[model samples]
Each structure stands twice: as C-alpha cells, then as structure tokens.
Target: MAKPMRRLMNPALFICDLQEKFRPAIYEYPKVIATTQKMLKACKILNIPVFATTQNKSRLGETCEELGLDSPDGISTKVHADKTAFSMWTPEVRKAFADLPPTTPPTAKRECIIVGIESHICVTQTTLDLLREGHKVYVLADGVSSCNREEVPIALARLRAEGAVVTTSESWMYECMGDAGIQEFKEIAKLVKETKDSTQQSLQTLCKI
Candidate 1:
C-alpha cells in the first residue's frame, strides 16, 4: 500500500472545463464544483498559485458561475481560458498560466491539482500533459466528473498506471497546507466549514424535492 504520508499534493490548482453547458451532463458536477471552490479558497488563503481552463467559452459559455473567479483586475469573472483544446497549451491557456510565479523554490516547477468536468476529455488530457511537463499532477477524484460514472473510474485507472496521484478534495487541501495549527489554519478552517455547510444545504434541498 502506498503510504498516505507519501501522497503529497500540489499547491497549485488547475480547474478545467466546468462550464455551465458542461455541468448538467456530469453526474457529480454540483458536489464536485462545491469541493473545487473550497479547494480554490484554501489555495488562495495559503498564497498558492491557481490556473484554470475553459473549452471555447464562446460556444460553451463561462466556467460555472459558482467558482467565483476573479479577473486580472480582480473583478471576479467566470470566464477564464476561452480555449479550443482540452490541454492548457493553446496561446490563451499558455499566456494565463505562464505568468504565475511558482509557489515553491525557484527551481521547482509549480505543483498542479486538477479538477473539472468530463474526466475522459478535458480533465484527462490536461492532467496527462501536465505530468509530461514534469510538474507534479494531483487529480482531485471527488472534484472531477463525467457524464458516465464508468469513464471516471477508467480515467483514474489510467492515470494511476501512469503514476499520477489520485486524491480527494479534502485530503489534498489539508496535505497541501500540511497542518491545521498554523495561523492560516483558522482561515482555511472557515472556508472548509462554509463549504461543508453549503454542501449539506444543497443536498438537503435536492432531497426535499
């Protein structure tokens, strides 16, 4: 068994195409999006870098409004990548991530935690490409979804075969920060509580109807 201690996660988060058009088709989009938002908040509080991609925003619309992404000017726009491909290698994609300063030491490439829709398409391709680039790729299993549940498991199997670390949103978040006693812990704890409360409320509503 792989030691849980060895399952270190990346501080950088790469949110893929969780757009409005894309979410309704994915089985766990609501849950995944909620977790992704929490993970994003944790990263932000810890001063970790974050990157996101969208698949042709003109066609699909923006990343789901729930993400609360801020513009470069900090206006909080839902649109991010506006790209054609699944991988963040397009001119637009490259420009967005290229400017982010690494969170770790100067020599270390940024670690990327990827979460998004259609595990077999955008999520799968992006994770593979990042792994190829020598960056640590941590796939947030609970935060990625597909229209078909089977596809997600298959994609995860392939990723594990290729040595990608598969993890959950909560696990990855705590690991990235490494401890809950630091001053920042209280801040992240608040975000985590907010996420849990919101998720429970959403689930309760879904059950009521």
Candidate 2:
C-alpha cells in the first residue's frame, strides 16, 4: 500500500495553550519546547510570521513563561487571545487577531503552522476551526502536547481526518527548507542530530537494568 504524503505551502506558525501551570505534566515537555523554539528560529530565518494563543491570562499567564520565550527583544508577543472555547475564533480572539490589520481581506489570508498543549482540547478545536476557515493548517506533533498520551493519538487522528497535516518539528524544518543544501541546513542538521543523540541516550539509560 502507498503511504500518505502532505505538501505544505506558504505556512506561518501558530502556537496555542502551552500554558505555565500545565506544561510540566506533558509527556514530552522538553522536546516540545526545544522543537518549538527550533521552529520559531527556523521561521525567523525564513521570514515567516508567527502568532501565539493563550487560554486564559489570569489563570495561565503569558505563553513566554510556558514556552521559555526569552529573547532580548522579547518573544514577539502579539495580542494574546484569551478564550473560553477550545476554538480560537471567539469574538475576543477575533478582535485581538484583527489588531494585525491584514493587507488584504479573508480570501488572501495566509496559512498557519500550529503547535501547543492539551491536544484533545484547544489544539484540536483551533486547528479544526482554522481548516474550516480555509487556512492550511500544519500541526507540529513534537511541538504539541496533551495531558495524557491517549489524547495525543486521538487528537492526531481527529485533526488528520479533518484535513490537517500532522508533522514533527524536524520534518517541518526540512520541509520548509525544501533542500538539505543551504547554510541554514547545517545548523538545523546539527540540532536534529543532537536531538537524536539525546533520545538514544535516554532510551539506553532506560534499558540498562
């Protein structure tokens, strides 16, 4: 049988609800954070716009603390959309997002690459909504998390069935790069190799009974 393939085009980046009080509980917190930062770095180099959404600021606070978005110039905190719905298209969110002032109207909108926590809830709904709105959505699996492992697989299946492309941070990097022959590729390759080495070490330590 032939496997499925996704061809991503003109994708921006969106990160949702990887909040402060909740991040540590996820199965792959460190990998999610590191991979997200790598994606942000790749986006920056590629000149891609990035947006981040938070669930509730009063309870969760900003996304920077959760994602460790510590840049001297700051993490490019656009208007943080606080939402009650899992979907980010609430009135408040729509208003906050409208602060960006698009150069063109609805049909010309750009695609967004999304990542975040609680895969079965906020991440799932937001992606579904985005897809409905005719935006190409790329879900970064390694850059996303759920409170339980079971939710992750379920969320992935739901999103894939709904037309979202499920991809990892490294695959996203190379996909965005399109070729392994650029100067930036060297840095990304080093990062990927390091990540592989770290996973191997962790697995080896686990096997050393």
Candidate 3:
C-alpha cells in the first residue's frame, strides 16, 4: 500500500499599514510593534516571505522603521506597497502573490499570517480578501490593534467568525513550524526565549480587553 502524502504549508506574512503616523493613535501600538518584530524575526529564521503595505505613505508615513521591512536581512519582503484601499490585497500585492512559487505538488493552499494596525479596517479587510482568494488567514491577536481598544476584540471576533484563525504570535509560530525536529527549530526556540519578556508584555497589553 502506498503511504499518504505529507501536507505542506506555503506561508507568507502580511503587514498592514503599521505606519509611523498612527503610532500615537493606535491603542497599545508599541506592544503591537513588539509582537510584529518578533514575528518578523521568526519569519527570517523560517524563510517565510513577507509582504507589507502602507496606507497612503505620502500622508501616513512609511511602515515603522523599527520593523526593518527594507532591510534584506531583517525580513524577506516580497512587496512593500503603498495603497489608498483599505485592504492590503492591492494589485501590486496580487502580482507578487502570483509570482511566488507554487506549493510543492500543487495541492496545498497558501497560508497568510497578518500583523498590523487598526484591526477594524485594513487588517479586517485584508483578512476577508485573503479568505475570498482561497487562502488560510491567521490574524495575530497580539500583533493587531485599533485607535480604540474596544474595536480590536470586535474585529477579531468578526474575523474569527469569517473563517480566519485568530491566534497569538507564539502559537502561530509554533503551528507553522509544526515540529521541533525541523532544521530551524533551534533558532526559533532561541528567539522565543530571547523575546520572552517582551512577548508576555505585548500579550498582556495588546490582548487585554
């Protein structure tokens, strides 16, 4: 008898409108950035491609420099775009998505992990659009926020209802890694340890009601 084929995950990171201008307005914005930084570091270790967007960069400013979206060694940025639309799923991003190598054996759908600002708007729309495109979406609870903290939970609940998996950054990282035996496990483990304090603080601040 033939053995069943192993499933594979082709995942990408989506950073939505975590720009400089909104840092002062978004609730717990620092915590959001901290969580996103952790994810970006993990993505670098795991070799996952990253796509980032800014909402009208002319007015909103660029994605926070601290995330290092432009640094080749910091994050594997496939497309860093500026958009007027609420969704990060713009034409440029779509084209970049199309250009990615197909999943091995072509059977697994891509998985998108999102982290960013204004959970009720850009993040929510991005999640919905990705779901519509037949991709599995995971929105990091600790990596998303809004001007009003109240909006965060509501947006998360709606996305969860809409089929997106609402999970924390650490949980999603492990889920993506899937095994301690993988080659990147040691590095990831170290990252988790190094960011322990910050992670806990971020969770408490960003996930609190």
Candidate 4:
C-alpha cells in the first residue's frame, strides 16, 4: 500500500455540488451530510483548507444548510466556488488554492480529499483531472453519492482502478489524527461518535456494492 497521508495540518478538502436541490436524488442524504459534517469539523480543528463548488447554484440552489457551507461575509476558511462545469478544477477553485495562506508552499501540492454528491459525474471528473495533474486524490466513499444507486459503485470502481484512493470519512480522519494524544482528539472522538449510528446504516448500503 502507498504511504498513508498524514498531512492534516495543510490538507485540502474538495466538497462538490452538495446543493439543496440535489438532495432528493442522492441516496442516504442525511448520512452523507452527517459524515461530511464530521469530516469538516475535523478539518477545521486541523486547519485543513477547504474548497467547495456549487454547480449552477442559480438552478440547483446553494449548498445544503446542514454542512454550514454558507457564511454571508464571503470570508471564512471554507472557500466557495460557484461554477457550471462538471469538473470543479475551475478557475475559481484554482484561485482558491492560489489564495491560500503563505503557510502553504507555492511549489508543492498536497493530496486532495474529495467528497460530495453525484459520484458518477462531477465528482468522478474532478477526481480524474486532479489525478491527471499528479495530485493524489482520496475520495470519501461514504460522503459521496449518485442519484442512480448503481452508478455510484461503478464510478467508485473506476476511480479505484484509475489509482484514486477510495476510503471512508472515518478512516481518513483517524489517519489524519494519527494519535489519541492530540488535543483535538476529544472533539474528533465526539464527532466520530455522533456519526457512527446513522453513517453505518448508510455505509452498509454504499459499501456492499
């Protein structure tokens, strides 16, 4: 296996097309949002950079409220990029990276942690593009979904075959934590606890395929 990512301090998170209108079609919408929320909280504690994309927000509506992706001030650690493109590697997203704090190296790019809706389309395209650009992509399977249940498994299988590391939100968070001694361990532990019940019910369905 490849050496696992332990770069939580400056990690990058890509949340794609998790809009309100997109919810009805997504399987296990509640659990996906719950797991994603847990992941986001962990990212905040670790100061992981976040880039969120909304596909045609005019029609799809904004990102769902459960995730707290909206901050009216247009100022927050979570950067929002509005786009019509399927691949979120749009200019806005690129600019988000460019706008990262000086703590981030201008030369080297870290692995991108990906999550969000419609696994077979935008999520898949973005994952492939990032991989093509030599960025290791880790897609959080439990946090990704498709309107057509069958398509998710197919897309995930293809993503894995293409060398994208497929994993669950919990596993990735624990990997990032690396130890129980970290001060943030308590918050992360609580977040993990809250999500386990509902998340497991959905993961059973998502992972079985």
As a whole number from 0 to 100, the lDDT of residue 142 in candidate 3 is: 90
The 10-residue segment of model 2 with minimum total lDDT is: 200-209
Q: Report the error of model 2 at residue 1, Å.
A: 38
Q: lDDT tens string, model 1, 13-47?
A: 77888789976687767877877777777766776
**Clash pairs of candidate 3?**
none
Best by TM-score: 3
Query: Candidate 3: TM-score?
Result: 0.94
Q: Which tens-of-lDDT digit does each residue in 20-120 have in candidate 2? A: 66666776666566667777666666656666667777886666563445456445545456666777667765655556546244446556688777778
> Model-by-model lDDT, in order?
0.70, 0.67, 0.89, 0.80
Give the residue spans of candidate 4 off by over 4 A.
1-9, 72-78, 102-108
Q: On residues 14-99, what C-alpha lDDT tens digit does candidate 4 reach at each position?
A: 98888899778888777677777877777777767888989999888988877886555222445688888899999878877768
Question: Which pairs of residues collide in candidate 2?
Answer: none
Better of 3 and 4 by TM-score: 3
Clashes of each: 0, 0, 0, 0
User: What's the lDDT of the predicted structure labeled candidate 4?
Assistant: 0.80
Best by lDDT: 3
Would you list the clashing residue pairs of candidate 1? none
Model 4 residue-pair collision total: 0
TM-score of each: 0.81, 0.75, 0.94, 0.87
The weakest ten consecutive residues by lDDT in model 1 span 1-10
